[model samples]
Target: MILALYNRQLVEKRSDEAIFNELKERSNYIENDIQSKLLEKNKISLTNIFELTGKDLGISFTIYDNTLQIFNSMDQYYKAGIFAERINPQVYYNLNYLSFREYTIKENIEEYVFNSFYKKISVDNKNYILAVNDAFNKVRLTFSTSDLDVLLFGIYLLAALIIILISTFLADKISSPIRRLTKATMSVAQGDLNVSLDNQEKGELKDLLDGFNLMTNELKRNQSELAELEREAAWKEMAKQVAHEIKNPLTPMKLSIQQLIAAFRDKNKRFDEIFEKVSPTILNQIESLNSIASEFSRFAKMPSYKIEEVDLANVATDVINLFTDEAVDIQLEINDQLPKISADNSQVRRLLINLIRNSIQAGASKIKLLINHENNFCNLVIEDNGKGIAPEITDKIFEQNFTTKTSGMGLGLKLAKRFLDGIGGDIQLIESSKPGATFKVTFPISQKNSFI
Candidate 1:
């Protein structure tokens, strides 16, 4: 509005020369009036024209003719009347000739200058030019950019925090079940065949868990079937042994009775002597048959165990004392500091007695019993310097009715192994080579109730 008013006033004049004369006259009048006021206040200079224009209109102004006057809002004043050629001769010429150009200007303020918008206005007949500027626009733009940067930073920070929280929650949810499955798999590998997993998860993991549970159940069922088949085979083998033992004595008894009948028929004088010999033979064979029957009965009807905490070394010592009259040399090596094991007293004693009887029957001259603690177990090692079991039949040594002895039932070692198994203990043939046989019995330190 101010620029339009000034342009109209300048355009109403007659020519370019008249326009310049009129502007100079107005400038002198304003300067003289300001100087008159300063004189009254004992001042000698004219008041700053830029300060007056900015206070009234919030802008800076400049005028160019043959001379130049530049004023700014900062209360600066510059004049280059005829000496303008000494200041920047090309700059004054461009400002005078470029009457319609409007562009940005850079001028020093304090120690630096910033860009500000300016427009050039032509007076009547292109005799003079006026420049108008607004410098504070750049200050508003700087403040706006700073505020935008702060807002963008806050938004990015919030997004990153939210992503971290979500990632943590998802990781826990996914890994927790996998950890449980890993623990369950370890339990299965360690021989807990009954271990299984829950099928409570969703998607592919749920299918995998269900499949694992089914596999465990199938494994358990297969194991049970195999155990049943082994039991049947053992029973059939025992029956065959019984038949063979009974046939051995029956054949000799039949021969002796037939010879006595023949002698009686002949009516010889030595018939009485032959009858006496035959009578004792028949009696001995009957006793042998009775012994076989008794052994089978005992094997078939194993006694139930009475579980209790007992010192295995003491039990071994008692078994050793029982064989004092025997010709074989028996020695006991025991660690007295060993922890008490949970077992039935009578069963342990019987198990030791059977092993010792086996060594004596095998023609062992020396037997050693070692008792100690190792790896959370109580170990009882029985080593014998006897004719070791043949490699061909080593695996069958503990099978029911399987024996290498001439006048013995094979139930001894089988019954011993069964007894140990019933009490949560295990027996293994550590070595069975010539000149010696070693057997190891291990029992867990802590026992729970178990039965066969």
Candidate 2:
């Protein structure tokens, strides 16, 4: 539609110039013909000259000498004899008045138009109709062109506005999704795991959202597990120290009761032998009580390490040997290049023993101890081929009083971890379940001097 409008405007503007040029040529032709005929006939009067020129030249003619005016209409084609005879002389007179309004004479016969204006002039005693058409045609052309230019400009402006609006709408539509995704990403980065995208577009962006969701979920889960593990570790350390402190006073009481029972067992004290027999029984009970109290006291004491150079492999070997009497099968793999660690030898040995014993108690048939040096630290890993712990219970293994063993005070691994911690080391339940458990003990090089 716009193209058509522009074409129409162009044609309208150019048409005026075309018509004016055509009319100027036609007027020149007419003037030349009139002069040529007048010179040929040597006529002086306008009225007589018109009749002669009209007859000889085969074109309708017009001549005016003030009151005696003459005029004739010629078809656009000016086909000489054919159009001259059919020409309306009165219509030509009306054309002279219409011409004053800047009009063009066009006909289907010529498929063309011409624009000009008419005026009367005196040559000698006769008057002639002189067409002064240049400025007249120019003015008509100018007005026509101006109107066309206005229409074309209006269309261009409208098109520009439409294009601008369409571009703005599309830009917002495309950018909105990206903006939403950006905000969602920032929220996720800031630890909001529940952020979701509303876009259902099936493309790479949707895939990206899926990936982002997965990453956030994993991070949240890991963070939760880490917090829980820290709490368990803290509680385990506190409980272990408490138990260790509480076990100290019961040892001497158990011995005193046993000595009193033995004294009553003599023959001179037969009647007292009865009391002596009861005394030994009471002493046995006291000893048992004393042992229990001692275990608790030991469980509650916080480990204080004296750092020294110590061989982690020798400590691991001794821990394994400590459990050699058990029915469980054990294997030890210690790295020969294991660096001397700076830690309390006694605490490290206890850490290893606790882990090995825990694995054996978990119904593990074959226990594997791997000791190695890594990252300027000694790493002791005790793995058992028993049933692995349930995922739910594995995290709670380091908690005080949280135990899988019926025989333990539930402070073995707990205390071991505390002692390891006191020596700038850590004991971790690396893996576990009904299948088996693996405990890792890492002792730093700074504590190596105490171990030695």
Candidate 1 lDDT tens digits, 1-452: 35444544454332333433433343444334434444464433223543553454443445445454444334333332322212234444555566434333444457764343333433223433343332332222222334544655676678779889999988877886677677656545544454446567899889878888888778767866786798799799999999999999999899999999999899978899998888999999999999999999988767577777787877787667655545679999886588888777666776777787677767799999989898778999999998988899989988988988653446667977887787768999999878889999887675554443
Q: Pick by lDDT: which candidate is best?
A: 1
Q: What lDDT does model 1 reach? A: 0.65
Q: How close is every model to the real structure, measured as TM-score?
A: 0.45, 0.34
Candidate 1 residue 281 C-alpha distance from true site, Å: 4.8
Error of 1 at 82 (Å): 27
For model 2, the stretches where C-alpha displacement exceeds 4 angstroms are 1-13, 21-134, 137-144, 235-239, 248-452
Q: What tens-digit string does per-residue lDDT give for candidate 2 at 383-402? A: 88877788887667777778
Candidate maximizing TM-score: 1
Residue 216, model 1: Cα distance from true site in angstroms: 1.2
| Runs of candidate 1 exceeding 4 Å displacement | 1-47, 55-69, 72-101, 104-115, 121-143, 257-452
Compared with the true structure, all predictions reach lDDT values of 0.65, 0.61
